[model samples]
Target: MIVTSFFSLFISQTVFAKNMYRWIDDKGRIHYSETVLPKDINYRRESLNKAASVKEVVEEAKTKEEQEMEKRLVRLRRDQEKIITRQKVYDNALLNTYHSKADLMMAIKSKMDAFETQNQVVEGNLIRLKQELEAQQKNAAEMDRNAQKVPKKLLDGIKSTQKQIQELHIAINEQKEKQSQIKREDEADIARFLFLTQSLTEKRKGTSIPSIKEANELGLFYCENDRQCNKAWEIARTFVEYYSTTPPDVYNDKLIMNRPPATDTDISLSLSKIPLTDDESQLFLDVHCRESSLGKDLCVSQKVKDIRATFIPYVNDALSRTAQ
Candidate 1:
């Protein structure tokens, strides 16, 4: 019985020794053994065959912080993907909705006209209701002067008229809000349409140097290649941020811009990276002011002209420095 038990122990030892397990301990020391311990199971490990070649590798379990960071990265990527998808949908709708800027303007005008007509009707009704309310109030006051009890019907009419006035006021306010919202939406659509169509049209025109007047009007900076444009884009971004009175808004590879001007004097700046060819691009700077006469004047002022004039030189100097 003793001999048989010894033989069995030898066989088990030989079988276990056929493969080796290598792992790192908590102290980051490497260890190799014929068998892995339960305590070392969570550590990153490798299994080697009899030839001493790695047969399998197991990654270490992530810590709590590592796991949380991974989850956050995943969520960020998902949100970015959602934004991209939504933008594509909007672009498609904008392209399909109108053939040109004129069409878009016409559509906007029609909608505004309808709203204006509705508001006029509401105003007329409000005037009539107020006159009626005034007459009812006078009748009530006369009854009170005579020391007569005002009828319940008259009192109820006064209350009803007051309630109608309150409701009409709310409706008028809501209508005005709607008109403002419509204007904003239409403006956005127009801007996007102009960008999409203009970029395509300009790309077909090929790269060319514009005249001083054209450059000032368009705020254009030409680049001969992708490398130059990439460098120029960064410089253009700084220029936009520095000159724009409004806070930053949308930023992406193709466009960088600030929020629309809130006051007549405030200037909003934008840069569009338009592809001229497979290897060439142009950075276009645009200045915007509030949608008022004063704002229009501000956009054409010397201050704005100076801003546009510097765009090309600013980018050129930046590129020259980088080249050096």
Candidate 2:
């Protein structure tokens, strides 16, 4: 009975428990193992039974610094997604709100007219309330000067009239402020609406952004002929991240295609925003080498020189800290 129970338990664990140890090696490649990890390596435990993609599982394993970097990346991706979702919602709302700039202008004018008419009513009431309160105060002053107690009803009337006048003033100011805000918002909305609509029309007519894969292919075109293909793959992964996130305007004028109709010119890239940090940037930039008949590969771009200049010092600085 004991042997049969033990066998059943073993079978259940083998079938149901798909525990995995995920880790990144010194070379930054992600690895997954079912039973044993490398003799000296630390791994993060993961359950493969869960619906996690291989990419997500790999991302789950990282060093402390890598984890912080990933956190920042996740936050940025979330913020970008929100911006895209908000843009879609605004685009829909814009379409439903008005048919043309003229239509929007007319709508704004009508709202302005309504506000002006309401404010005129409020102003007239405020004038009347002020007059009544002033008259009541004068009456109370006259009674006090003659050494007589102010009439209770008259004092009450004065207080109530003053309150009404204050309330009207507040209402008028609030209404005017809201109208100004609405006009400003409408102006911005119309501009954005026109831009978004125009872009959408152009996209429908076939002018569209390049796909991330296409951008990666473009970067790989120059590096794909490397002897082992290691450098090319690394460059492709880095380019994929860069192309997907960086604004096209930053490099639209300076796109370097390695195997184009032009000769090899070392390109220097400076972006308004760099998605990779110092170390992460070095990891990809360090892979640039071309096979030459003279036995050793010479550097092509001054950009690569800059990378080496900064990366070596950065690594040394980090190593010094560990030594301390």
Candidate 3:
């Protein structure tokens, strides 16, 4: 009977060895493992431990491959968020930097100038490649067509022409790929430059006068009279920014008052009134002519005369509006 009990105990231990390990972590969470829990752990053993319940914990004990995959997934999500945020910042910079049409126009012009210069070099390479390819193709076609009529003495010449044709196609393809690569690089550079420029422009807007009304309160009139003139100055500033300099006289001339040519001393008669020069008026008109009668050609004599006649009435009318 003692021998029989010994055999039964041995069988029970063998069956228990096939089951999983179970334990609770420091955080009060249960865990399971195929291996026994270490004695160094502080957790109290549970009386309710069952092999079936601990099976789930053992299943969750991730392999190295699974752990690495999970880490990669987490990193991918984080990287995607960073990419989205970066794109948003780039877009916002473009929007906030270009406060005026003139500033945007200048930026565009600068981009075009740089792009055009580089494109010329690319174009030259492309043209050369195309010409060589065409010449090779023509030679090949002529050789192939003549092969049937030609003697064996010229067979080597035909083979040489075929080889030249193959080489030409390879050269053409290489040049084309190079051109494409250059174009992509150029586009990326242009995009980066635009983003930087836009950010700078937006930052500049913060330091500038906020609005026409605020400018009028400060007595910084550039053309016209009172608040209208102040508003015109804001518009003019935008144009100057875009153009990268003062606009042409034609645009600026429109803002001048029709005064008979005054000598320097005549212009100094009124202490309170700062006389507006024709050039100054022209600058204002060029920068801010959204409603001028002569359109963009206002600097022409006939257009100027027409604009002056129409503008004087409008300015007088605008003065009354300002007081209200």
Over 1-324, each residue of candidate 1 has an lDDT whose tens digit, in order, gives 686578546544554446788787989676778888888888999987766668999899889999999999999999999999999899888888888889989999999999999999999999999999999999999999999999999999999999999999999999999899989988888877876776566667764556546875678886756888888888889999999999999899999999999999999999998876676677899999999999999988999988988888788888889999
Top of the candidates by lDDT: 1
Model 2 regions lying over 4 Å from their true place: 1-39, 42-61, 68-72, 200-324
TM-scores for all candidates: the values are 0.54, 0.46, 0.26
**lDDT, candidate 2, 1-324, per-residue tens:** 796678546544653345555555667655555665555245443445423323233333468998899899999999999999998898898888888878878887898899889888888888888888888999999999999999899988988888888888888889889989988998898777666665564478564322334423222122112332333333333343342322222222123223211213322223221112222121222222334422122344444444434432343344446558
Clashing residue pairs in candidate 1, if any?
Answer: none
Residue range 242-323, candidate 3, lDDT tens digits: 3222222222322322222123111100001233432222122222222334433433345334433333334445555756
- Pairs that collide, model 3: 97-202, 102-242, 103-242, 251-286, 252-282, 252-283, 252-286, 253-282
**What lDDT is obtained when candidate 3 is compared to the true structure?**
0.47
Flag regions of model 3 displaced more than 4 Å: 1-153, 201-324
lDDT per model vs. reference? 0.86, 0.54, 0.47
Between 1 and 2, whose TM-score is larger? 1
So what's the TM-score on candidate 2?
0.46
List CA RMSD, all candidates: 17.0, 17.5, 25.0
Cα displacement (angstroms), candidate 2, residue 261, comes to 22
